[model samples]
Target: MSAQDDVDDVGEFAALLRALKERTDRSYGSLARRLAMNTSTLHRYCAGEAVPVDFAPVERFAALCGATPEERLELHRRWLLAVAARRRPRTASAPEDEPDTAADPPPLPRRPWYRRRRVAVGLAAACALLATLASLSVLPDGRRPAADRAPTAGPLASGTTEAKAPDRSSPSPTPSDSPATEQPSASATPKKKPSPAPSARTTAPPRSGRKPAAVPLTWSANSQAWKLGCGHDYVIAKPPRQVPPPPAPQDAGTWAATQGAVHGGETLVELSVQGRSDTAVVLNALRVRVVGRTAPAPGNAYAMDQGCGGAVTPRSFDVNLDKDRPIAHAVAGSDTGVPIPAVRMPYRVSAEDPEVLLVTARTVTCDCLWYLELDWSSQGRRGTVRIDDAGHPFRTSGIKGLPQYTYDTLARQWTPDS
Candidate 1:
């Protein structure tokens, strides 16, 4: 299907996912781990703000939710319809009772009293009376207005001179002066040189001061933990995914250097704690540092707060290179990347929350990717940190443009890196 079709399918695709999620009754965090993605990202998919790019994730998610094979087929069918609808023209038919404004109305003939015979006769008499009065004004016009005849030869392009209102800028020319005015000389030098072209410093004011609640990234010194304060961004936190599947070890370097650098791509720095299912993993701190510069790595962003209005938002950290960043940073603004300062892991999954290690590696360029390495110092028990799933150091986009040199996971194509 076309790219447009995929975007349009967001709503229906999201609805099905929402229902599937409820059927499983799981938390976003649990599900993300199960799906190998971020809890925040899964929320976006289910909220209709974004659609699943890879059917693999969707299929796996469905199976985890215990969706019957037939039900899964229906999900796929609806997904296809939603995507197809996107490509379909939104033109709607007009109501049968409504008039079609496209057609022109018949022209009306202009008729009035001034065009009638009686009115015409009355007008002629009035003109004759005005002429007689004029001829008699002050004894045949005391100095018979000096022959108002216009001069035929003059500098004026249209030579026949006519009466003109005097210009207010300068005193009216004395009658003795020659009527012809001289045009400027070609020898005269040019006036002020056009101001130099504006510099790059002049940019559309950076989008700021307009903040829809930030993801209340809180750091409680006493607790030594990061907490997501209650806000619209996290109103109803979708349960974490079902028991997570085995990890698919991806090469952070190969993935980031090739795919993460796409001009309009997205990268997610997902987190997975090291612990048992019932253990509550508290995050200490994570930094998105720019250690080196890589060629062609321009500004990009991490997708957040798109639809997180009142409920707990998904925790899947996604980066959309196409979206603008919130702040004015040197490399990429909000799109540049996210800096989840020292935050406490305040969310608890279950009674058996055990510490788990998030596997990660040196992924893509700092400019295009946000590799989050967690700190386990604050946890009651040092939780193992693993970083292989969703929101890894580097993740691909749902949809990507024709890549000049970057890899497009959707297309499974790219201009092989040098």
Candidate 2:
């Protein structure tokens, strides 16, 4: 059957996988080869017959097909749902109106001959003891013996002897001296100590307190400067010819570090945050901290993507570094340049539901060294996570009227952008 037909049988996850695969216009064998998996397994995943154990394969497949970040996030959501569904137990359906026909219970097993004999012997001994007690008490008369009767509180008649009360102060009688019918003294009986009460720590649920140094939220931040249609650019002291062609998006961070590049004109910081556990984390705020400000660095700007058309605009916040105190303001719409009334704070994220914040800090006056602090709370624990460019503050400077260059596809060299 076709992938679409299989998707109809399975669910939305398979449908999305098939759609992404179809967009690439590649056969299962070719895609599977690139993904380093068996074609049949890939087919099963796309056809909804099976789900991948790990999301790594699914993400690699999406990247191979050039899925947008938003699409990748949606795919991750669907994958999480699929995983949950697979784990949930299914109960058998039954008609509530109909009464169940009870089956006959199995017969009890017979006791061993030796065990039955032992029980019979015990019963006989009990019967003999009861007969002996009756014979001793009756004395061939219908009345019970005087010793066997309960003592009366009234005074005794002239011919009758008075009963004496036992003295609690005296030592307990020996077992041989005590009457067979008498119970042991209360003092002689061993008292049981009450079981110790369970400890509060063991019985009660754990109390909420300050979490450890490691917060439950996991995050990564990347700083890049974009111009025109280019996603990331760098300002380096060396000329354009001295630098190699721009690296792929995944390698952009390392490439920038290697070239000793700094952000020019504007710096876009992308922060990806997700919870380490299944519990949801509330992102309280994203605050900016300016480390220092200096004059713009002297360098020529180089664009990563020269001829690429347009760029993907994610939900972003704008920060103007020229102000004494810069705050992140949420943008209303893509390319609208309208700031929302309030920042997008108090957002929820989880292992399954992640969040990405695009922060664009622009400056025309001074070079700024800045970093972000993300406040988050989860399960009653609140903390702040420092976001930076690989353990260092992100540096962005104004490039007003400085030399700017773009790679020319036709010339196979860097050419000045008009």
Backbone clashes (count) for model 2 = 0
Off by over 4 Å in 1: 1-9, 84-418
Clashes of 1: 67
Q: State the local distance difference test value for candidate 1.
A: 0.29
> lDDT for each of the candidates?
0.29, 0.51
In the predicted model 2, the residue pairs found to clash are none
TM-score of each: 0.24, 0.48
RMSD of each: 35.7, 35.0
* 194-307 per-residue lDDT for model 1 (tens digits): 111100110111123232211111110000001111110000011112111111111111211222222123222223232222334455544332212222222222111222
Residue-level lDDT of model 2, residues 1-418, one tens digit each, is 2333323434888888989998887899898787656676678778776665345567778989889978877777676556434422122322578432221112222222111100000010111111000000101112223234221110000000001122235344333322231111101001211111100000111123322233455554435324321455567777777977775442344455456666666777656576656899898988887766766666787777634322113347898998899998887432224323333688888755555566888887766667677777777766655555432345667778679888776777888989
Candidate 2 lDDT trough over 10 residues, lowest sum:
153-162
